[model samples]
Target: MVSRQAGLLLAALVALAGVSVVGGEVVDAPPTLTVENDGDTTYRVTAYTVESVEDALLTNFRVTTPAGENRLVTYSQLVWPAGYRNVTVTDSVPSQQVTVPPNEAVETEIRVWEPGDVTIYIIEEPDDETHVWSDMKACTERQQEHSIRLRDGYEGGGSTCASDLDLLFR
Candidate 1:
């Protein structure tokens, strides 16, 4: 029932108060980890390092490709169309420690020639290590928070740290 002049005055007052009353979709930030393809050849899980990201946060990323060739990739930025196998940590890797200054990661790689499975494990028990863990937290989709702790060993579903990181990403 407001007149045009009154509505304009109200909008001006709202703008002066720095309030936005517009109805619009609220976008969420993308996760640090996502499944992506490397060039035209392979897929990779890239951990995006942003300013809000705390350094030395344990993200025990593991990829166990039983059949195809796999590796720790740093440079590929292409977002592979949402199709991935969700590989795990397996086999053995003869990898040189390559640091991508932007990604801030240390990784392992392995390839299996024979048909049998290759079991690979990475970054174990952050608590047992000399590295200091920050008070990073994990939160569920419901927005409940939990403490981030690395287990003595990776108990299968995912590495403890990776699982917690997944939680935080939600």
Candidate 2:
């Protein structure tokens, strides 16, 4: 009877909504950050600005690439303390263009262009946003990172990224 009751409890928990799983710790889904390159090159770039604890842009820190490549991207460099909170986080990326391989998701890194306390959030490509963002704990942190490569003549792609709940409430 005890075993049966435990199974039932597990089923009840599974039925609940808004549960996510991340790094073995259950958390809500993260937001999606999307980007596109509409120029004539083999690489592309996207930029996002992380907000300060007051939900305003923190201008103290500057973002740049250590590598000399013109294709380097510094999407996330601003950092924040663990307990830091912000009700709103806004992102801005100026329009740019480039070319990429056809139907491939490339792997790359965005280091700290400027040193600061900011959380890095990269958008996921070719994923089910609805299912991923479902209220489940097993889906919090991303398991792997990948980005879609636009083929010649392809227009654009849509993606999203989720933020920690602490930031949402702040």
Candidate 3:
């Protein structure tokens, strides 16, 4: 005959096993894409995946304005895990371009079900032509290194533009 303590221990072990089986594996949170504007001029930031993979998943595209407003850019859906989505600045007066005013910031967050890379473009539309101010590539392996802050007409993290300017000014 088993002791009462042994019976309770066995019941606890069985319960833990059941719970583990029911819960399965825990999923990781999707990666994030953040863009900060610290320059005097306004900009429109856009992000999109580079290449679409067959087994990859992309969903929950959200765009947050500088004024603390949250808006849904895309519905929760699966798409080829590669391609660029022009992130519209929701706070701008003109709807055609999402504008980030001076000293303001914007962010685009999406749920990435697969591992891939993305490209973010900082564009300026002064006239009919759209000029690309800066662009940075982001991947899962380098997600933390991807946050870009545009300050004094230069993007952070040792961008080539900064180097070029340094050489030109010297």
How far is each candidate from the true structure, as Cα RMSD in Å? Answer: 17.4, 14.1, 15.5
Superpose all Cα atoms of candidate 1 onto the true structure and report the RMSD in Å to 1 decimal: 17.4
Query: Which has the better TM-score: candidate 2, or candidate 3?
Result: 3
- Using lDDT as the measure, what is the rank order of every candidate, best first? 3, 2, 1
Pick by lDDT: 2 or 3, better one? 3
lDDT of 3 by residue, 5-113 (tens): 8978855754543322234542222335455777777666444443332211232344343344545443222121122233343321111224576888765543432
Q: At residue 124, what lDDT does model 1 achieve? A: 18
Of 1 and 2, the candidate ranking higher by TM-score: 2
Better of 1 and 3 by TM-score: 3
Residues forming the 10-long window of minimal summed lDDT in candidate 2: 129-138
Error at 68, model 1, angstroms: 17
Top candidate on lDDT is 3
| Alpha-carbon TM-score of each model against the true structure | 0.17, 0.26, 0.40
Clashes of each: 6, 30, 6
lDDT of 1 by residue, 27-131 (tens): 222222211112222112212222222211322323323343343321111112111133222223322111222223223322211112112222211222211
- Model 1: colliding residue pairs: 63-88, 64-88, 90-120, 91-118, 91-119, 91-120
Error of 1 at 37 (Å): 6.9
